[model samples]
Target: MSIKPAIFLPELLRHLFKRPVTVKYPFEKEPVPKDFRGNVVFDPPKCIGCMICVNDCPAEAIEIIRVSETEKKFKMLLHNDRCIHCAQCVDSCPTKAYHMDSEYEIAAFSRRHLKIEYK
Candidate 1:
């Protein structure tokens, strides 16, 4: 097979001179669209301690701990690392305790930081 550098050179040079296609991340922030599921936000006041969200969650990221049986108080532990962000918790919660947050830049150096606790 014969090789021709001249045929590819023009196409490469044309794209090289043109402006880059990628958006400058960090320098320019992109907004999260409406109803975009980023992170799970737990509302303690709205929680009913049903554990529906915990059961429905495919990743088993949500844990509902009953703080007080008489008081009906509950604590929610959300593992961001384990969470698939499927929004199943939000949908499954009978009391609407789980909601999705707009903040998508949830990068962390340690897994401990990713764990969110709601009381």
Candidate 2:
């Protein structure tokens, strides 16, 4: 009896003869895409501390603490663990204070380090 050949045989052979598709990490750093949503950054000066970002964030990853009402500047804090990269805060900012940066390699064993305060 004769058996049918695999349809992926040609593709498999082509890949086998070709070079490796992946590069070694740590040794070689790849460039991130322009629109890649790696992390969020907040500009303290641009932000009026109106709490729009804190209130609009879907993941509730942002916090605005009122250090002093007389000072008129609140501390903008971010919890990376709670952030889902939804970009809601970026879109909700009235003064374009928050922006998404291309830096997704934030691996860590501790969750405390993920929390950042932009002052």
Candidate 3:
């Protein structure tokens, strides 16, 4: 059998002059697409605490607590570890309290860091 490796020579030579296909993610962030579903954001002033978003969320990321008879506390505990990013909560809010933000760089070293609490 021949010991000379000629097949790898062409691939090595072609890659030597080519630009890197990988992106520098930490330094350069790409803009999110218009239709891309991302993290959820809540607006307290616009929210009526109707619990529609809490009811419709498949992931059960939202929790509403009654603070008093006059006021109801809205709590959205977004556990990114469990979230599917389907944008279902945004569509279910009748008061337009929930929105899908474009900030999608949500990598974390621990699962605790991935949990976002909004009150």
- Clashes (N, CA, C under 3 Å) per candidate: 0, 0, 0
Q: Pick the candidate with the highest TM-score.
A: 2
What tens digits encode model 2's per-residue C-alpha lDDT throughout 1-119?
Answer: 65445766888888998999888787888898888898899887786777878888888899887677677666788999999999999899999988999997987799999998988
Give the best candidate by lDDT. 1
Residue-by-residue lDDT tens digits, candidate 3, 17-79: 999999888799977789888888877767777888788889877776554586665556677
Error of 2 at 76 (Å): 1.0
Model 1 misplaced stretches (Cα beyond 4 Å): 1-22
Candidate lDDT (C-alpha), each: 0.89, 0.85, 0.79
Tally clashes: model 2: 0
Measured by TM-score, how close is model 3 to the native structure? 0.71
Residue 1 of model 2, lDDT score? 61
lDDT measured at residue 35 in model 1 versus the true structure, 0 to 100: 86
| Model 1 vs. true fold: TM | 0.78
Model 2 gets an lDDT of 0.85
Model 2 misplaced regions, further than 4 Å: 1-19
Per-residue C-alpha lDDT of model 1 across residues 35-59, encoded as one tens digit per residue: 8999999889888888788789999
Can you rank all candidates by lDDT, best first? 1, 2, 3
